[model samples]
Target: MASSTTRPDVETAAPSARVAGRLLDSSAKLSYDPLTEVDWETPLDTDFHGASPEWSTLYGTSYWDELTEAQRKELTRHEAASVASTGIWFEMILQQLILRDVYAKDPGDDAVQWALTEIADECRHSIMFARGAKKLGAPAYRPRRVAVELGRAFKTLAFGEAAYAAILVAEEVLDVMQRDWMRDERVVPFVRTINNIHVVEESRHMKFARDETRKNLAKAGPVRRHIHAFVIAVAAYVIVTSMVNKGVYANAGLDPERALAAARSNEHHKAMMRSSCSGLMDFLASARLLTKPALAFYKRAHLI
Candidate 1:
C-alpha cells in the first residue's frame, strides 16, 4: 500500500513542476529594453557642428576645431575608449550591487527592478561606445571586466552602507560633469549623445542612491558598528579619487599623476574636488560614520 501511495505522489509532483516552470518564465521578463526605450535617432542641435565663429570665442572651440582631421580622429578614438571604460564601470557597479543584495539575503523586488533598469542602461551605454568607435574607424575594444583582484578586494575591504553612499556622491559629481561636457560647443555630436543618454538616466539613479541611502542609514542602529557601511564609504573615496586620476585625465592623453599634481596646483579642479569631497564627508558625518578620525584620515590622504 505504501509503494502504491508513492506513485500517486510522484504523479501529483508533475503538475506542480509545470506551474513552477511558468512562474520562472514570467519572472524572467525584462523590465526594460534599451533599443526601444532610448531616443537613438535624436538630432543634434547646430552648436555641436562648430558653426558659430563667436562660439569659438566663448569656449576654446578654436583650439579644439583647429586640430587636423587626423588629430580630431585620434581624440575621438580616445573618447570612445573613455566611454567604454565608463560603461564598464557602470556594469561593475550593477553587478556589485546584485552580489551584495544576494549576500545580504534581503533582496527586495524593488532592488531587482532597479538592477534590471541599470543593466539596460549599461548595455545601452556599451552599444553607444561601440558605435562611436565604429563611426570613428577606431578598433573597438571592450572595457576589461572587474578583475579577480577587485572582487577579492571588495570581499576583504567593502562596507555596504558607506560604499553605497560613496557611489551616490560619485554619481552626483559625474552627472554634473557629463552635463557640462554635453553642453560644451567643442564636444563632438556623438560624444554629446552618449553623455546626454547617461545624464538622463543617471540623474534618477543618483537621486535614488542618495534618498535610499538616507533611508537605510536612518534605520541602521545609531551605533556606528555597521561594517558594511564603513567599507562602502572607503570604496567611494577610492573610486572618486581614481576617477580624476585613471578614469578621466588618463584617457585624455594626460598623465594622471601629473593631472593630480596639476589639480592640486590649479585652483579650479582643486576647489571642485574639495567641495565635492566635503559633500561626501558631510553625508557620512550625518550618518554618524565619519568620525573625526575618519575626516583627519581623508585630509591626510588628500581625498578632501
Candidate 2:
C-alpha cells in the first residue's frame, strides 16, 4: 500500500524540500556529537593559539606588531573565546526562529524534520562552545545591551526570507573563519576539532537556509522584498559587529579603548571579511535581495 500510494504533495514540493531530503540523508551519515568528539580533558596549552593568527582582528595592525609573541597568542585566545560566545548568542536566536517557522507544520515532512534536526545540532553546538570557552580560560563574552535586545526582537518577529537570509549571513561569516582555523596547525587541536564539526554541520544549515530564502522570496511583492532586504542587512551588520566583544581587549591585558579602535579600523580584518563574504554577496545579488538600502549596511560591515 505504501509503495502504491502516489503522494502528489511530494511531486509538487518546492526545491527547498527536495534539498532538505538530501540533507537529512547526509546528516544521518555524517552528523557529529561535539561532546564525544572533542578532547575535553586536555589542559589548555599556552603554547598553542586558539585560532589561526591570520584570522585575528588586529593581526596586521601596528599595535599587534608591537605586542610580544606571548601577548599575541594570548590576545588570539581571548578573541577566539569571544567569537565562540557570540556564536552561542546567534545560535540561540536562530533556534528560536527555526522553531517558530516549523510550529504546527507536518511533523513527518522531511523539511520540518530537518529543521528540528538543525535545532538539535545548534543546541549541541551551544553547549560545545560554552565548554570550549571555559576550557580556554576566558570569561563569558557577550554583545552590547542594544545588540542583544535587537537580536531578541528579530528572533521573535522575523519570518520567511528575512529570517532565513539573516541565518545564512551569520553562518557564512562564521564558516569562512572556521574553515581556516580547522586546517591551521598553529591552532589548538581541540579547537580545530570543534571548528571542523561546526563547519561540517553548518554546511547543511546554510544550504537549507539558502533554499528557503529563495523559496520565500518567490511569494514576496516588491514592497515586502525591499523591507526584508533592508532588515537582513541590518541583521548582518549587527551579527558581524558583535563577532568579537570589546571586553576581550581588556581581558587580554590590552587597553580596551586602543584595542577597540584598532580593531574597528583594522584594514586586514576588513579585507578578510570582504574576501570571505564575496560569494555570499553574489548569492544575495542573485536572489535580488541586494537592494540599494541593503548595500549600505553591507559596505559598512565590509561584507560586500
Candidate 3:
C-alpha cells in the first residue's frame, strides 16, 4: 500500500518542486544587488521625470495642462516617490505573510527555499525603494490611517490563496507601470535601473504567487473560496488606492483640492488601470475567485 502511494505523492509534489527549482535557478542567473547597481553617487537631476507622464494620476486632467514642464516633472517625481513608499509598506506586509505561511513547513522543500529567496528579494526591494524615494526629494508618504490598520489586520490573518492572490494583485499592478517607466527615456536613469531590477525579480515572485494561489484554492471548499475572494478584492482596493498619496499634489506645487478633484474624475487614468490589470482580472476569473461581490470591489478600484 505504501509503495502504491509513493508514486502519487511524487506526482503531486513534482509541479511545485519544478517551479521552485526553476525559480531558484533563474534567481541565481540574473539577480541584482541594487546597492551597487544604482548610481547613488550621482547628483539628482531635476530635468528627468521620476516616472512616465502618462502614468501620472493627473495626466489627462485639465489641471495637468496648466502646469509648466518643470512643474509636471516635479509632480511625477513626487507621485513616483509616493508609489515607491507604498511599495515599501506593502512589501513589509508581504514579507511577514510569506514568513508566516512558511513557518513550520519543511525547510528542505524547494518551495520553502524559494519563499525565503523571494523574501530576501523583497527586503532588498524595500530598501531600494526607500533610497529612491529620498533621492527623488519626496517626503515619506505613508498610506492613510484606515489602510494602515487594515493592512496590519490582513497581514496577520490572511493565509493560503487569500494571501498569495493579494500578493499577485500588488505585483501585477506595479509590474505594468514599472514596465513602462523602465523603458521610458524621460525617467531618471537610476530610477529606470531600479524599476528594471524590480521587474526582473518580481516576475518570478508573481509566478510563484499565481501557482500558490491555485494550489491553495484547489483544497478550499466553495464557502471558503467565496470568502477569500472577497477578502482579496478588498485588499486590492486598498493597495491600488494607496499607491499615490494625496500629499503628492501639494508636494508638487499643485492645488491639492483641484488636483484631487481632477484626479478623481480622470477617465484616462482609470482606463489605464483597467487595461493594465486585464490579465490579472482574467487570471482571477479563471481561478473562480471573481465572485459578484469581488468584482464590485475591483470595479470600484478601477482594476476591472
Worst 10 residues of 2 by lDDT: 1-10
What are the per-residue Cα lDDT tens digits for candidate 2 across 1-304? 0133334465467676778877777787788888789999999898889889998998899989988888888888999999999999999999999999999999999899999999999999999999999988899999999999999999999999999999999999999999999999998899999999999999999999999998999999999999999999999999999989888888889988998899988999999999999989999999999999999999999997
TM-score of each prediction: 0.59, 0.95, 0.96
lDDT of 1 by residue, 215-261 (tens): 56766774543554555545544544444223333443445565445
Name the runs in model 2 displaced over 4 angstroms: 1-14
> Per-residue lDDT for 1-304 in model 3, tens only?
0121222233456898878877877787788999999999999999999999999999998899999999999999999999999999999999999999999999988899999999999999999999999999999999999999999999999999999999999999999999999999999999999999999999999999999999999899999999999999999999999999999999998999999999999999999999999999999999999999999999999998
Off by over 4 Å in 1: 1-80, 83-87, 102-108, 127-152, 155-159, 222-230, 244-264, 275-282, 296-303
Q: What ranges in model 3 sit over 4 Å off?
A: 1-13
Model-by-model lDDT, in order?
A: 0.49, 0.92, 0.95
Task: State the lDDT at 191 in candidate 1.
Answer: 62
Candidate 2 pairs with clashing backbones: none
Task: State the displacement of the C-alpha of residue 37, model 3, in Å, after optimal TM-score superposition.
Answer: 0.4
> How high is the lDDT of residue 104 in model 1?
49
lDDT, residue 263, candidate 1: 45
